[model samples]
Target chain A: MIIKNSIEGSFHLTGGDFTNAGIASSELKSILTELGLDDNVIRRAAIATFEAEMNVIIHAIAGTIYYSIMPEHIKIIVNDMGPGIEDIELAMQEGYSTAPDWVREMGWGAGMGLPNMKKNSDEFKIDSVVGEGTTVEIIINIKQGLR
Target chain B: MNIHEIASKLSLDVKTTKGDLEREVTGCYISDLLSDVMANGKEGDIWITHQTHPNIVAVAILKNLSGVIITNKRVPEEDTLKRAEAEHLTIMTGQAPTFEIAGMLYHFLRC
Candidate 1:
């Protein structure tokens, strides 16, 4: 992580690479822990980012997670190249997934990815094009504030 | 109960070092869905799953789980063992079905 006014950096993800799947999110969690952020905030960030990272790995050809941390909050933006969601509403519903059998065999691609991400993050925004890609942005505030 | 004691009683295949063998198991969580575990699993819980991937180790670490039980006699991948060893996380294997072992584990930890 590069530190100036905020701790910010980006991690690149390669699709179908399970060998190093959680490394990026793990590193982020470590940094937040060292910075002495609230434990809840750190956990929420870890879970949200991990779900996003797995999305890129399971579905995208490539993806990148860009994050910035300030004293009050942490922000993450995950962008991926994949067959983007055709219906965001349906995709966000729990127990809805289009992942193939291979992904299912690994104990992933259960329809809970999006719902879990949304459940953990304080602010979540997603946008996608049917044939191009998807982007997810998440922010978790350390201190209580307006939603 | 501690992991080592549990291992002996269950006849589990211990795959990691001894450092955490004496660590107490605080609870139990059984699931194959990674997201469900992430969303609901608690720290110090012993996880039981059919998944033998390294990411299972990652989730164990993320939740500060006591260890992971790979049920159905499925061996963990080499990478998974390496990761767990590096972190000093306990991992064991059992031949029984996931639910059966989970029941045994729940009895050990909760009863």
Candidate 2:
């Protein structure tokens, strides 16, 4: 599916920057709200982007999130450089997490990040290579007249 | 019940006035885990948690929560307060523990 009317933006993320993990999602929420998208769609996009952003902060060395908003859908791609996931299938489990103890102590890393992202997104894709990096792409469809 | 009424009944300290006190409270959710709240919390629900970080505000905004009540007198971080103010999110502090606050909110909302 191709959307004709679209707006795009990108943000650079630094690894271990827990303090600023949600900035991109916050900005995206505002952008979506300003564009008058449905509240449910905005919420889903925000949650998915926030989870992906948290993953980048907790696990990657550095990353960038590229987002595009269209009348029909929103697309977000998060690419990171770090030690990638060894087992993609296992990682999708609800309670599976590799976050360190310190990250868990911060009330995160309950192994819900990827699962929650997938739950909120209409389409979710994750690609990773060990010792190289991981990339996550999510699409949230904005249904018309579904408010 | 509205946020102000609930706060008054529970004797919650109004830490920040960024959010509307008159906003109606539909329900309440108690948790410190951000993802749990995001996944299960309903819009207009007040979130009760012990976590005091900027990300908490982010989560509250995403969930469209009516307000956030921080239990045990734990203050929000400076950055959290700033973000809350910017987002117009209510941040309240209570001297009681999570259990007590949750009970009070439940009783107040029920009434």
Candidate 3:
């Protein structure tokens, strides 16, 4: 556990698993809380991690979130195995979504996933191969603590 | 206001088991977008939306919302009710649209 001098952890996510889509991000949130990060930073990280986890659950076959904590900031990398985005620029647009009506009825797939991730993150980067998979990296700086 | 007061006042159909309607609701957030709620919805806010999927319960849990109201009398999915019950998150339904429900809450909260 990170509470005992640990600085990084990874949580696995399964695609098409609506029953447990949020487990990974909540796990990440718990680790952040255990590490005693600033509340604001934890909230930002939680939003980004949750969006990343949802992207994987909605689009990928499987995924893993790599969490790392430094004295200055928290870094989260979500890597997934599935069909990647065909158009990064289009996907970044706030209202452009490829998800079906079923996902929309679930209150997600509003094309806000990536935008929300970027909005809550101090730094964000995304990479994907159309036939392969996608990876999202997000960083949230600690507002009240520095070392 | 507490959830019990609002539920009783509105005559809502409570759909969960012993959902502790006594929890204080600080505010209300009306949104059908999960990300929008995640970005802007405050803790202890009751969420009003047309979404009935189980993920709504997950969102309510993540945000620590006082309760969830599915407007237009839309009953949540079985899994949603089950999860809400298991999580002790209050799930209710009303015969109003999203805007009307929001309006009603504003009136009650302002009083």
Best by DockQ: 1
Off by over 4 Å in 1: A1-4, A144-147
Chain A TM per prediction: 0.93, 0.94, 0.92
Residue pairs in collision within model 2: none
Per-residue alpha-carbon lDDT of candidate 2 for residues A1-147, written as tens digits (9 for 90 to 100): 234578999999999997787888888889888777778888888899999999999999999999988767789999999899999999999989999987876778989999999999899999999999999999988857134
Q: On residues A41-70, what C-alpha lDDT tens digit does candidate 1 reach at each position?
A: 888899999999999999999999999997
lDDT of 3: 0.86
lDDT of 2 by residue, B1-111 (tens): 999998898999988877899999999998877889989999999999989988898889888899999999898899899889988999999999999888887887876
Candidate 3: Cα lDDT at A96: 90
Model 3 agreement with the true structure over A28-136: per-residue lDDT tens digits? 7777777677667777888799899999999999999999887667889999998999999999999899988988878789999999999998899999999899999
Candidate 1 positional error at A8, Å: 0.7
Model 3, runs deviating above 4 Å = A1-6, A143-147
**On a 0 to 100 scale, what is the lDDT of residue A46 in model 3?**
84
Question: Could you give the CAPRI-style class of model 1?
Answer: high
lDDT of 1 at A141: 87
State which candidate, 1 or 2, has the greater TM-score. 1
Cand 2, B chain, TM = 0.96
